[model samples]
Target: MQTILGANGQIGEELARYLHNTVTHDIRLVGRRPSAVNKTDELFSADLTDAEATDRAVAGSEIVYLTVGLPMDSAMWEERFPVMMENTIAAVRNHDAKLVFFDNTYMYPQTAAPQVEGKTPFEPRGRKAAVRARIATRLQEEMDAGRVEAVIVRAPEFYGPGKTQGLTNTTVFNRIKKGERPLVPVSADTQRSLIWTPDASRAMGLIGNTPDAYGQTWHLPIDQDRLTYREMIAIASEVTGRKIRFSTIPLAVFTLAGLFNAPAKEASELMPRYGVDNIFDTSKFAAHFPEFETTNYRDGISQLLSP
Candidate 1:
Protein backbone atom coordinates (compact mmCIF):
# COMPACT_ATOMS: atom_id res chain seq x y z
CA MET A 1 0.00 0.00 0.00
CA GLN A 2 1.08 3.55 -0.63
CA THR A 3 0.63 6.63 1.56
CA ILE A 4 -0.39 9.91 -0.07
CA LEU A 5 0.40 12.98 2.06
CA GLY A 6 -1.86 16.01 1.56
CA ALA A 7 -4.40 13.77 -0.14
CA ASN A 8 -7.07 16.45 -0.20
CA GLY A 9 -4.96 18.64 -2.51
CA GLN A 10 -4.74 18.49 -6.31
CA ILE A 11 -1.81 16.14 -7.01
CA GLY A 12 -2.53 14.07 -3.94
CA GLU A 13 -6.16 13.55 -4.94
CA GLU A 14 -5.14 12.58 -8.47
CA LEU A 15 -2.48 10.17 -7.21
CA ALA A 16 -4.86 8.54 -4.75
CA ARG A 17 -7.52 8.08 -7.43
CA TYR A 18 -5.01 6.64 -9.88
CA LEU A 19 -3.65 4.13 -7.38
CA HIS A 20 -6.98 3.02 -5.91
CA ASN A 21 -8.47 2.38 -9.35
CA THR A 22 -5.44 0.96 -11.19
CA VAL A 23 -2.79 -0.28 -8.80
CA THR A 24 -4.17 -1.31 -5.42
CA HIS A 25 -7.24 -0.71 -3.28
CA ASP A 26 -5.16 -0.35 -0.11
CA ILE A 27 -4.19 3.32 0.06
CA ARG A 28 -3.64 5.64 3.02
CA LEU A 29 -4.35 9.37 2.77
CA VAL A 30 -2.52 11.64 5.26
CA GLY A 31 -3.81 15.10 5.92
CA ARG A 32 -5.59 17.30 8.47
CA ARG A 33 -8.91 17.14 6.71
CA PRO A 34 -11.21 14.40 5.42
CA SER A 35 -10.11 13.57 1.90
CA ALA A 36 -12.53 13.79 -0.99
CA VAL A 37 -10.81 10.76 -2.49
CA ASN A 38 -12.25 7.27 -2.83
CA LYS A 39 -14.11 6.23 0.31
CA THR A 40 -12.43 2.84 0.50
CA ASP A 41 -8.98 4.24 1.18
CA GLU A 42 -7.91 4.93 4.74
CA LEU A 43 -7.72 8.59 5.89
CA PHE A 44 -5.21 9.47 8.61
CA SER A 45 -5.45 13.10 9.68
CA ALA A 46 -2.26 14.32 11.34
CA ASP A 47 -0.03 17.38 11.52
CA LEU A 48 2.99 16.36 9.45
CA THR A 49 5.20 18.80 11.33
CA ASP A 50 4.95 16.57 14.34
CA ALA A 51 7.46 13.78 13.89
CA GLU A 52 5.50 11.25 15.93
CA ALA A 53 2.33 12.00 14.03
CA THR A 54 4.09 11.72 10.66
CA ASP A 55 5.66 8.44 11.71
CA ARG A 56 2.27 7.01 12.56
CA ALA A 57 0.77 8.33 9.37
CA VAL A 58 3.44 6.67 7.23
CA ALA A 59 3.86 3.38 9.07
CA GLY A 60 3.31 0.22 7.00
CA SER A 61 3.24 2.03 3.66
CA GLU A 62 5.62 0.72 1.01
CA ILE A 63 5.91 4.11 -0.73
CA VAL A 64 5.26 7.64 0.58
CA TYR A 65 4.25 10.36 -1.87
CA LEU A 66 4.90 13.87 -0.45
CA THR A 67 2.44 16.25 -2.08
CA VAL A 68 1.93 18.57 0.87
CA GLY A 69 1.66 22.26 -0.01
CA LEU A 70 1.97 24.74 2.83
CA PRO A 71 0.01 27.96 2.82
CA MET A 72 1.19 30.36 0.10
CA ASP A 73 2.49 32.93 2.58
CA SER A 74 6.27 33.17 2.67
CA ALA A 75 6.26 33.18 6.46
CA MET A 76 4.28 29.94 6.55
CA TRP A 77 6.56 28.32 3.99
CA GLU A 78 9.66 29.44 5.88
CA GLU A 79 8.33 28.07 9.14
CA ARG A 80 6.53 24.88 8.11
CA PHE A 81 8.13 23.54 4.93
CA PRO A 82 11.51 22.57 6.37
CA VAL A 83 9.98 21.05 9.49
CA MET A 84 7.54 19.04 7.39
CA MET A 85 10.34 17.84 5.12
CA GLU A 86 12.53 16.78 8.02
CA ASN A 87 9.70 14.99 9.79
CA THR A 88 8.60 13.30 6.60
CA ILE A 89 12.13 12.24 5.78
CA ALA A 90 12.63 10.78 9.23
CA ALA A 91 9.28 8.99 9.13
CA VAL A 92 9.90 7.51 5.70
CA ARG A 93 13.33 6.34 6.77
CA ASN A 94 11.96 4.72 9.90
CA HIS A 95 9.42 2.80 7.83
CA ASP A 96 11.78 2.19 4.91
CA ALA A 97 9.18 3.63 2.50
CA LYS A 98 10.46 4.95 -0.79
CA LEU A 99 9.94 8.74 -0.96
CA VAL A 100 8.35 10.28 -4.03
CA PHE A 101 8.34 14.10 -3.73
CA PHE A 102 6.11 16.21 -5.98
CA ASP A 103 8.09 19.43 -6.44
CA ASN A 104 7.99 22.63 -8.50
CA THR A 105 10.63 24.30 -10.74
CA TYR A 106 10.99 27.39 -8.50
CA MET A 107 14.50 26.49 -7.30
CA TYR A 108 16.11 26.97 -10.73
CA PRO A 109 17.12 30.38 -12.08
CA GLN A 110 14.88 31.93 -14.71
CA THR A 111 15.47 30.68 -18.27
CA ALA A 112 13.86 31.17 -21.68
CA ALA A 113 13.61 27.50 -22.66
CA PRO A 114 12.16 24.60 -20.78
CA GLN A 115 14.21 23.94 -17.64
CA VAL A 116 15.89 20.57 -18.11
CA GLU A 117 16.13 18.20 -15.16
CA GLY A 118 19.63 17.95 -13.64
CA LYS A 119 20.76 20.73 -16.01
CA THR A 120 19.23 23.78 -14.33
CA PRO A 121 21.33 25.82 -11.90
CA PHE A 122 20.22 25.94 -8.25
CA GLU A 123 20.41 29.69 -7.96
CA PRO A 124 17.38 30.71 -5.93
CA ARG A 125 15.92 34.17 -6.60
CA GLY A 126 13.45 34.52 -3.73
CA ARG A 127 12.59 33.37 -0.23
CA LYS A 128 10.25 30.57 -1.31
CA ALA A 129 12.78 29.37 -3.86
CA ALA A 130 15.48 29.20 -1.20
CA VAL A 131 13.30 27.05 1.08
CA ARG A 132 12.41 24.68 -1.75
CA ALA A 133 16.05 24.44 -2.81
CA ARG A 134 17.16 23.65 0.71
CA ILE A 135 14.49 20.95 1.07
CA ALA A 136 15.52 19.36 -2.23
CA THR A 137 19.18 19.54 -1.22
CA ARG A 138 18.35 17.84 2.07
CA LEU A 139 16.59 15.03 0.24
CA GLN A 140 19.54 14.65 -2.13
CA GLU A 141 21.91 14.48 0.80
CA GLU A 142 19.80 11.76 2.40
CA MET A 143 19.87 9.73 -0.78
CA ASP A 144 23.59 10.27 -1.25
CA ALA A 145 24.27 9.09 2.28
CA GLY A 146 22.11 5.93 1.85
CA ARG A 147 19.82 7.19 4.63
CA VAL A 148 16.68 7.12 2.42
CA GLU A 149 15.58 6.30 -1.10
CA ALA A 150 13.85 9.23 -2.82
CA VAL A 151 12.86 10.73 -6.20
CA ILE A 152 11.73 14.28 -6.89
CA VAL A 153 9.15 14.86 -9.63
CA ARG A 154 8.93 18.47 -10.80
CA ALA A 155 5.92 19.86 -12.69
CA PRO A 156 4.81 23.08 -14.31
CA GLU A 157 1.59 24.94 -13.50
CA PHE A 158 -1.49 22.77 -13.12
CA TYR A 159 -5.01 23.11 -14.63
CA GLY A 160 -7.65 20.40 -14.48
CA PRO A 161 -10.65 19.17 -12.55
CA GLY A 162 -10.42 19.64 -8.75
CA LYS A 163 -7.87 22.38 -9.34
CA THR A 164 -10.17 25.27 -8.46
CA GLN A 165 -7.55 26.90 -6.27
CA GLY A 166 -4.92 27.11 -9.03
CA LEU A 167 -4.07 30.50 -10.52
CA THR A 168 -5.58 29.82 -13.95
CA ASN A 169 -8.78 28.51 -12.51
CA THR A 170 -9.16 31.04 -9.70
CA THR A 171 -8.23 34.12 -11.75
CA VAL A 172 -9.28 33.08 -15.26
CA PHE A 173 -11.23 29.89 -15.94
CA ASN A 174 -13.46 30.15 -12.91
CA ARG A 175 -14.27 33.71 -13.87
CA ILE A 176 -15.04 32.51 -17.38
CA LYS A 177 -17.24 29.80 -15.92
CA LYS A 178 -19.04 32.48 -13.95
CA GLY A 179 -19.49 34.79 -16.95
CA GLU A 180 -17.15 37.37 -15.42
CA ARG A 181 -14.28 39.12 -17.14
CA PRO A 182 -11.17 37.14 -16.32
CA LEU A 183 -8.53 39.00 -14.34
CA VAL A 184 -5.11 37.68 -15.32
CA PRO A 185 -1.72 38.58 -13.90
CA VAL A 186 0.19 38.74 -17.19
CA SER A 187 -0.42 40.04 -20.67
CA ALA A 188 -2.62 38.08 -23.04
CA ASP A 189 0.25 37.47 -25.47
CA THR A 190 2.60 35.93 -22.89
CA GLN A 191 3.31 32.27 -23.54
CA ARG A 192 3.28 29.76 -20.70
CA SER A 193 2.93 26.01 -20.18
CA LEU A 194 0.68 23.92 -17.99
CA ILE A 195 0.25 20.27 -17.09
CA TRP A 196 -2.95 18.31 -16.70
CA THR A 197 -3.01 17.18 -13.07
CA PRO A 198 -3.81 13.58 -13.89
CA ASP A 199 -0.92 13.30 -16.29
CA ALA A 200 1.50 14.69 -13.68
CA SER A 201 0.10 12.45 -10.97
CA ARG A 202 0.37 9.44 -13.26
CA ALA A 203 4.00 10.26 -13.92
CA MET A 204 4.64 10.26 -10.17
CA GLY A 205 2.88 6.91 -9.81
CA LEU A 206 5.00 5.41 -12.58
CA ILE A 207 8.21 6.72 -11.06
CA GLY A 208 7.30 5.53 -7.59
CA ASN A 209 6.89 1.96 -8.82
CA THR A 210 10.08 2.02 -10.92
CA PRO A 211 13.02 1.14 -8.71
CA ASP A 212 15.40 2.64 -11.22
CA ALA A 213 13.84 6.06 -10.72
CA TYR A 214 14.87 6.21 -7.04
CA GLY A 215 17.44 8.73 -5.81
CA GLN A 216 17.07 11.05 -8.81
CA THR A 217 15.01 14.01 -9.97
CA TRP A 218 12.58 13.77 -12.92
CA HIS A 219 10.51 16.38 -14.73
CA LEU A 220 6.89 15.52 -15.43
CA PRO A 221 6.07 15.61 -19.13
CA ILE A 222 4.06 18.67 -20.27
CA ASP A 223 2.30 19.70 -23.47
CA GLN A 224 5.11 20.67 -25.84
CA ASP A 225 2.89 23.14 -27.68
CA ARG A 226 2.98 26.27 -25.59
CA LEU A 227 -0.13 28.44 -25.65
CA THR A 228 -0.60 32.10 -24.84
CA TYR A 229 -2.97 33.15 -22.05
CA ARG A 230 -5.41 34.56 -24.62
CA GLU A 231 -5.40 31.29 -26.49
CA MET A 232 -6.16 29.50 -23.25
CA ILE A 233 -9.26 31.68 -22.76
CA ALA A 234 -10.24 30.92 -26.34
CA ILE A 235 -10.05 27.21 -25.59
CA ALA A 236 -12.21 27.70 -22.51
CA SER A 237 -14.68 29.67 -24.59
CA GLU A 238 -14.81 26.89 -27.16
CA VAL A 239 -15.23 24.20 -24.54
CA THR A 240 -17.92 25.91 -22.47
CA GLY A 241 -19.71 27.71 -25.29
CA ARG A 242 -19.16 30.94 -23.37
CA LYS A 243 -17.91 34.23 -24.76
CA ILE A 244 -14.94 34.41 -22.45
CA ARG A 245 -12.85 37.59 -22.43
CA PHE A 246 -9.95 38.59 -20.19
CA SER A 247 -7.98 41.67 -19.09
CA THR A 248 -4.39 41.71 -17.95
CA ILE A 249 -3.16 43.36 -14.74
CA PRO A 250 0.49 44.24 -14.82
CA LEU A 251 2.91 43.70 -11.92
CA ALA A 252 2.92 47.42 -11.12
CA VAL A 253 -0.81 47.31 -10.49
CA PHE A 254 -0.40 44.35 -8.19
CA THR A 255 2.52 46.01 -6.48
CA LEU A 256 0.48 49.12 -5.72
CA ALA A 257 -2.55 47.05 -4.72
CA GLY A 258 -0.31 44.87 -2.55
CA LEU A 259 -0.16 47.64 0.06
CA PHE A 260 -3.79 46.87 0.87
CA ASN A 261 -4.24 43.29 -0.39
CA ALA A 262 -2.19 40.66 1.33
CA PRO A 263 -2.83 38.08 -1.35
CA ALA A 264 -2.07 40.58 -4.07
CA LYS A 265 1.19 41.53 -2.36
CA GLU A 266 2.17 37.88 -2.17
CA ALA A 267 1.15 37.35 -5.81
CA SER A 268 3.15 40.34 -7.07
CA GLU A 269 6.38 38.58 -6.13
CA LEU A 270 5.61 35.81 -8.67
CA MET A 271 4.78 38.17 -11.54
CA PRO A 272 8.13 37.49 -13.19
CA ARG A 273 6.70 34.23 -14.50
CA TYR A 274 4.08 36.14 -16.44
CA GLY A 275 6.82 38.08 -18.19
CA VAL A 276 8.71 35.01 -19.49
CA ASP A 277 8.11 31.69 -21.19
CA ASN A 278 8.23 29.11 -18.42
CA ILE A 279 8.59 25.65 -19.89
CA PHE A 280 9.76 22.33 -18.45
CA ASP A 281 11.71 19.90 -20.59
CA THR A 282 10.79 16.31 -19.88
CA SER A 283 13.07 14.55 -22.36
CA LYS A 284 14.67 12.54 -19.56
CA PHE A 285 11.25 11.42 -18.36
CA ALA A 286 10.28 10.56 -21.93
CA ALA A 287 13.41 8.45 -22.33
CA HIS A 288 12.71 6.73 -19.02
CA PHE A 289 8.98 6.15 -19.49
CA PRO A 290 8.48 5.69 -23.21
CA GLU A 291 4.79 4.92 -22.90
CA PHE A 292 3.95 7.98 -20.80
CA GLU A 293 1.97 10.73 -22.55
CA THR A 294 0.94 14.30 -21.69
CA THR A 295 -2.70 15.33 -21.97
CA ASN A 296 -3.00 18.27 -24.31
CA TYR A 297 -4.78 21.52 -23.46
CA ARG A 298 -7.84 20.88 -25.62
CA ASP A 299 -8.69 17.60 -23.92
CA GLY A 300 -7.64 18.82 -20.49
CA ILE A 301 -9.72 21.99 -20.81
CA SER A 302 -12.70 20.00 -21.96
CA GLN A 303 -12.43 17.83 -18.87
CA LEU A 304 -12.22 20.87 -16.58
CA LEU A 305 -15.22 22.48 -18.24
CA SER A 306 -17.34 19.37 -17.97
CA PRO A 307 -19.95 19.12 -15.23
Candidate 2:
Protein backbone atom coordinates (compact mmCIF):
# COMPACT_ATOMS: atom_id res chain seq x y z
CA MET A 1 0.00 0.00 0.00
CA GLN A 2 1.17 3.53 -0.74
CA THR A 3 0.48 6.14 1.97
CA ILE A 4 0.70 9.93 1.92
CA LEU A 5 1.40 11.78 5.17
CA GLY A 6 -0.15 15.29 5.28
CA ALA A 7 -2.51 14.40 2.49
CA ASN A 8 -4.59 17.59 2.70
CA GLY A 9 -1.89 19.97 1.49
CA GLN A 10 -1.67 21.23 -2.07
CA ILE A 11 1.36 19.11 -2.90
CA GLY A 12 0.07 16.08 -1.04
CA GLU A 13 -3.34 16.32 -2.71
CA GLU A 14 -1.81 16.52 -6.15
CA LEU A 15 0.62 13.71 -5.35
CA ALA A 16 -2.25 11.53 -4.16
CA ARG A 17 -4.21 12.19 -7.33
CA TYR A 18 -1.21 11.39 -9.50
CA LEU A 19 -0.44 8.19 -7.61
CA HIS A 20 -4.05 7.04 -7.68
CA ASN A 21 -4.49 7.79 -11.36
CA THR A 22 -1.16 6.54 -12.71
CA VAL A 23 0.59 4.32 -10.19
CA THR A 24 -1.67 2.58 -7.69
CA HIS A 25 -5.27 2.41 -6.54
CA ASP A 26 -4.46 1.18 -3.02
CA ILE A 27 -3.60 4.57 -1.62
CA ARG A 28 -3.81 5.81 1.99
CA LEU A 29 -4.30 9.46 2.96
CA VAL A 30 -2.94 10.51 6.38
CA GLY A 31 -3.66 13.83 8.02
CA ARG A 32 -5.56 15.35 10.91
CA ARG A 33 -8.48 15.56 8.55
CA PRO A 34 -8.05 14.20 5.02
CA SER A 35 -10.64 13.79 2.27
CA ALA A 36 -10.15 11.05 -0.27
CA VAL A 37 -8.75 12.04 -3.63
CA ASN A 38 -9.90 8.71 -5.12
CA LYS A 39 -12.72 6.32 -4.30
CA THR A 40 -10.52 3.48 -3.07
CA ASP A 41 -8.20 5.57 -0.88
CA GLU A 42 -7.99 4.68 2.81
CA LEU A 43 -8.09 7.62 5.20
CA PHE A 44 -5.66 7.46 8.13
CA SER A 45 -5.82 10.40 10.51
CA ALA A 46 -2.71 10.86 12.68
CA ASP A 47 -0.48 13.63 13.96
CA LEU A 48 3.01 13.03 12.59
CA THR A 49 4.65 14.59 15.66
CA ASP A 50 3.49 11.62 17.74
CA ALA A 51 5.74 8.60 17.33
CA GLU A 52 3.19 5.92 18.10
CA ALA A 53 0.54 7.62 16.04
CA THR A 54 2.95 7.93 13.12
CA ASP A 55 3.86 4.25 13.48
CA ARG A 56 0.19 3.28 13.29
CA ALA A 57 -0.20 5.50 10.24
CA VAL A 58 2.66 3.84 8.38
CA ALA A 59 1.97 0.27 9.40
CA GLY A 60 1.58 -2.18 6.51
CA SER A 61 2.69 0.37 3.95
CA GLU A 62 5.17 -0.46 1.21
CA ILE A 63 5.92 3.12 0.22
CA VAL A 64 5.31 6.32 2.26
CA TYR A 65 5.39 9.85 0.98
CA LEU A 66 6.11 12.71 3.43
CA THR A 67 4.52 15.81 1.98
CA VAL A 68 3.55 17.44 5.27
CA GLY A 69 3.44 21.22 5.45
CA LEU A 70 3.09 23.60 8.38
CA PRO A 71 2.07 27.21 8.63
CA MET A 72 4.74 29.85 7.90
CA ASP A 73 5.50 30.44 11.55
CA SER A 74 9.23 29.98 12.27
CA ALA A 75 8.66 29.09 15.90
CA MET A 76 6.18 26.41 14.96
CA TRP A 77 8.54 25.03 12.35
CA GLU A 78 11.48 25.07 14.77
CA GLU A 79 9.47 23.26 17.40
CA ARG A 80 7.61 20.68 15.31
CA PHE A 81 9.52 20.02 12.08
CA PRO A 82 12.39 18.10 13.69
CA VAL A 83 10.08 16.00 15.83
CA MET A 84 7.92 15.19 12.82
CA MET A 85 10.95 14.24 10.76
CA GLU A 86 12.27 12.02 13.53
CA ASN A 87 8.92 10.36 13.98
CA THR A 88 8.53 9.79 10.24
CA ILE A 89 12.02 8.31 9.85
CA ALA A 90 11.49 6.00 12.83
CA ALA A 91 8.04 4.93 11.61
CA VAL A 92 9.21 4.32 8.07
CA ARG A 93 12.16 2.30 9.40
CA ASN A 94 9.95 0.23 11.69
CA HIS A 95 7.54 -0.56 8.86
CA ASP A 96 10.36 -1.21 6.37
CA ALA A 97 8.66 1.13 3.91
CA LYS A 98 10.44 3.27 1.38
CA LEU A 99 10.12 7.02 2.09
CA VAL A 100 9.73 9.72 -0.51
CA PHE A 101 10.27 13.13 1.16
CA PHE A 102 8.95 16.29 -0.45
CA ASP A 103 11.25 19.21 0.29
CA ASN A 104 11.61 22.88 -0.68
CA THR A 105 14.46 25.22 -1.68
CA TYR A 106 14.42 27.38 1.49
CA MET A 107 17.65 25.86 2.82
CA TYR A 108 19.62 27.14 -0.13
CA PRO A 109 21.05 30.64 0.11
CA GLN A 110 18.88 33.50 -1.09
CA THR A 111 20.99 34.42 -4.08
CA ALA A 112 20.91 34.57 -7.86
CA ALA A 113 23.18 31.55 -8.26
CA PRO A 114 21.75 28.51 -10.03
CA GLN A 115 20.73 26.00 -7.35
CA VAL A 116 21.87 22.48 -8.25
CA GLU A 117 21.14 19.30 -6.37
CA GLY A 118 24.08 18.06 -4.22
CA LYS A 119 26.22 21.01 -5.43
CA THR A 120 24.59 23.90 -3.59
CA PRO A 121 25.75 24.28 0.01
CA PHE A 122 23.28 25.12 2.77
CA GLU A 123 23.68 28.76 3.69
CA PRO A 124 20.29 29.34 5.20
CA ARG A 125 19.71 32.92 6.37
CA GLY A 126 16.60 32.89 8.55
CA ARG A 127 15.20 30.70 11.32
CA LYS A 128 12.89 28.82 8.94
CA ALA A 129 15.61 28.07 6.42
CA ALA A 130 17.90 26.85 9.17
CA VAL A 131 15.21 24.50 10.42
CA ARG A 132 14.69 23.14 6.90
CA ALA A 133 18.43 22.60 6.52
CA ARG A 134 18.62 20.73 9.81
CA ILE A 135 15.77 18.35 9.00
CA ALA A 136 17.06 17.74 5.48
CA THR A 137 20.57 17.04 6.81
CA ARG A 138 19.21 14.53 9.29
CA LEU A 139 17.36 12.75 6.49
CA GLN A 140 20.52 12.67 4.34
CA GLU A 141 22.55 11.25 7.20
CA GLU A 142 19.96 8.52 7.62
CA MET A 143 20.09 7.81 3.87
CA ASP A 144 23.91 7.70 3.84
CA ALA A 145 23.97 5.28 6.80
CA GLY A 146 21.70 2.85 4.90
CA ARG A 147 19.14 3.03 7.63
CA VAL A 148 16.13 3.29 5.30
CA GLU A 149 15.26 3.51 1.63
CA ALA A 150 14.44 7.14 0.84
CA VAL A 151 14.52 9.75 -1.90
CA ILE A 152 14.36 13.55 -1.51
CA VAL A 153 12.35 15.44 -4.09
CA ARG A 154 12.86 19.20 -3.86
CA ALA A 155 11.11 22.03 -5.69
CA PRO A 156 11.15 25.78 -5.81
CA GLU A 157 8.03 27.90 -5.19
CA PHE A 158 4.73 26.64 -6.58
CA TYR A 159 2.21 28.33 -8.95
CA GLY A 160 -0.88 26.40 -9.92
CA PRO A 161 -4.66 26.10 -9.64
CA GLY A 162 -6.82 25.05 -6.66
CA LYS A 163 -5.80 26.70 -3.43
CA THR A 164 -2.12 26.97 -4.30
CA GLN A 165 -0.41 29.46 -1.98
CA GLY A 166 2.69 31.45 -2.88
CA LEU A 167 3.88 35.02 -3.31
CA THR A 168 3.21 34.87 -7.02
CA ASN A 169 -0.20 33.27 -6.82
CA THR A 170 -1.40 35.54 -4.00
CA THR A 171 0.13 38.80 -5.12
CA VAL A 172 -0.05 38.37 -8.89
CA PHE A 173 -2.75 35.95 -9.92
CA ASN A 174 -5.31 36.55 -7.18
CA ARG A 175 -4.97 40.32 -7.38
CA ILE A 176 -5.39 40.31 -11.13
CA LYS A 177 -8.42 38.05 -10.82
CA LYS A 178 -9.94 40.54 -8.36
CA GLY A 179 -9.23 43.48 -10.65
CA GLU A 180 -6.73 44.96 -8.20
CA ARG A 181 -3.23 46.13 -9.00
CA PRO A 182 -0.79 43.28 -8.42
CA LEU A 183 2.09 43.63 -6.01
CA VAL A 184 5.54 42.37 -6.95
CA PRO A 185 7.74 41.55 -3.99
CA VAL A 186 11.02 43.28 -4.81
CA SER A 187 12.26 43.37 -8.38
CA ALA A 188 9.81 42.50 -11.11
CA ASP A 189 12.66 42.16 -13.57
CA THR A 190 14.47 39.25 -11.86
CA GLN A 191 13.77 35.80 -13.23
CA ARG A 192 11.67 33.37 -11.17
CA SER A 193 11.87 29.58 -11.45
CA LEU A 194 8.49 28.23 -10.30
CA ILE A 195 7.18 24.71 -10.75
CA TRP A 196 3.63 23.88 -11.69
CA THR A 197 2.12 22.02 -8.70
CA PRO A 198 0.71 19.12 -10.71
CA ASP A 199 3.92 18.65 -12.61
CA ALA A 200 5.92 18.53 -9.39
CA SER A 201 3.55 15.91 -7.98
CA ARG A 202 3.65 13.83 -11.16
CA ALA A 203 7.45 13.84 -11.14
CA MET A 204 7.52 12.85 -7.49
CA GLY A 205 5.19 9.92 -8.17
CA LEU A 206 7.44 8.72 -11.02
CA ILE A 207 10.62 9.00 -8.94
CA GLY A 208 9.14 7.37 -5.85
CA ASN A 209 8.00 4.37 -7.91
CA THR A 210 11.37 4.03 -9.64
CA PRO A 211 13.58 1.76 -7.52
CA ASP A 212 16.88 3.14 -8.76
CA ALA A 213 15.89 6.73 -7.90
CA TYR A 214 16.27 6.24 -4.15
CA GLY A 215 19.24 7.46 -2.03
CA GLN A 216 19.52 10.61 -4.15
CA THR A 217 18.05 14.11 -4.26
CA TRP A 218 16.03 14.96 -7.36
CA HIS A 219 14.95 18.49 -8.27
CA LEU A 220 11.42 18.43 -9.63
CA PRO A 221 11.11 19.34 -13.28
CA ILE A 222 10.40 23.03 -14.07
CA ASP A 223 9.75 24.98 -17.24
CA GLN A 224 13.08 26.06 -18.69
CA ASP A 225 11.72 29.38 -19.85
CA ARG A 226 11.88 31.21 -16.52
CA LEU A 227 10.01 34.51 -16.59
CA THR A 228 10.37 37.76 -14.70
CA TYR A 229 7.40 39.19 -12.82
CA ARG A 230 6.92 41.81 -15.49
CA GLU A 231 6.84 39.15 -18.13
CA MET A 232 4.59 36.97 -15.98
CA ILE A 233 2.15 39.84 -15.52
CA ALA A 234 2.23 40.40 -19.25
CA ILE A 235 1.22 36.78 -19.78
CA ALA A 236 -1.58 37.08 -17.22
CA SER A 237 -2.73 40.25 -18.91
CA GLU A 238 -2.76 38.51 -22.25
CA VAL A 239 -4.68 35.56 -20.85
CA THR A 240 -7.24 37.77 -19.10
CA GLY A 241 -7.68 39.94 -22.18
CA ARG A 242 -7.08 43.09 -20.13
CA LYS A 243 -4.16 45.30 -19.22
CA ILE A 244 -2.80 44.41 -15.78
CA ARG A 245 -0.62 46.81 -13.84
CA PHE A 246 1.65 45.89 -10.93
CA SER A 247 3.81 47.72 -8.44
CA THR A 248 7.00 46.37 -6.88
CA ILE A 249 6.99 46.42 -3.09
CA PRO A 250 10.36 47.48 -1.79
CA LEU A 251 12.08 45.50 1.00
CA ALA A 252 11.81 48.36 3.48
CA VAL A 253 8.02 48.47 3.23
CA PHE A 254 7.78 44.75 3.94
CA THR A 255 10.21 45.08 6.82
CA LEU A 256 8.29 48.03 8.23
CA ALA A 257 4.99 46.25 7.83
CA GLY A 258 6.44 43.26 9.65
CA LEU A 259 6.80 45.32 12.81
CA PHE A 260 3.02 45.32 13.31
CA ASN A 261 1.85 42.43 11.16
CA ALA A 262 2.52 38.83 12.15
CA PRO A 263 2.25 37.39 8.65
CA ALA A 264 4.23 40.21 7.17
CA LYS A 265 6.89 39.75 9.85
CA GLU A 266 7.15 36.06 9.11
CA ALA A 267 7.32 36.80 5.40
CA SER A 268 10.15 39.32 5.86
CA GLU A 269 12.71 36.54 6.10
CA LEU A 270 11.86 35.43 2.57
CA MET A 271 11.84 38.89 0.98
CA PRO A 272 15.47 38.74 -0.05
CA ARG A 273 14.77 36.00 -2.55
CA TYR A 274 12.47 38.27 -4.55
CA GLY A 275 15.10 40.96 -5.00
CA VAL A 276 17.29 38.85 -7.29
CA ASP A 277 17.03 36.12 -9.84
CA ASN A 278 15.85 32.76 -8.50
CA ILE A 279 17.50 30.33 -10.90
CA PHE A 280 16.63 26.84 -9.65
CA ASP A 281 18.33 24.28 -11.87
CA THR A 282 16.47 21.07 -12.75
CA SER A 283 18.95 19.71 -15.32
CA LYS A 284 19.45 16.54 -13.27
CA PHE A 285 15.77 15.66 -13.30
CA ALA A 286 15.45 16.69 -16.95
CA ALA A 287 18.30 14.37 -18.00
CA HIS A 288 16.94 11.54 -15.88
CA PHE A 289 13.31 11.91 -16.94
CA PRO A 290 13.60 13.01 -20.53
CA GLU A 291 10.05 11.92 -21.27
CA PHE A 292 8.57 14.36 -18.73
CA GLU A 293 7.04 17.53 -20.13
CA THR A 294 6.85 20.64 -17.91
CA THR A 295 4.02 23.16 -18.10
CA ASN A 296 5.25 26.45 -19.41
CA TYR A 297 4.23 29.81 -17.89
CA ARG A 298 1.86 30.85 -20.66
CA ASP A 299 -0.17 27.65 -20.59
CA GLY A 300 -0.17 27.40 -16.81
CA ILE A 301 -1.28 31.00 -16.40
CA SER A 302 -3.98 30.46 -18.99
CA GLN A 303 -5.30 27.46 -17.12
CA LEU A 304 -5.36 29.31 -13.81
CA LEU A 305 -7.12 32.31 -15.30
CA SER A 306 -9.55 30.24 -17.36
CA PRO A 307 -13.22 30.20 -16.28
What is the TM-score (0 to 1) of candidate 1?
A: 0.95
Which lDDT tens digits does candidate 1 get at residues 245-283?
679988789879889998877666667777777777888
Candidates in order have lDDT scores of: 0.84, 0.94
Q: Which predicted model would earn the best lDDT?
A: 2
TM-score per prediction, in order, is 0.95, 0.99
The positional error of residue 211 in candidate 2, measured at the CA in angstroms, is 0.7
Candidate 2 pairs with clashing backbones: none
Tens digit of lDDT per residue, candidate 2, span 1-307? 9999999988889988899889899999999998988899999989999999999999999999999999999999999999999999999999999999999999998999999999999999889999999999999999999999999999999999896878889998888888899999989999999999999899999999999999999999999899999999999889989988889999999999999999999999999999999999999998888999999999999998887
After superposition, candidate 1 runs with Cα above 4 Å error: none
Model 2 segments more than 4 A misplaced: none
Backbone atom clashes (below 3 Å) for every candidate: 0, 0
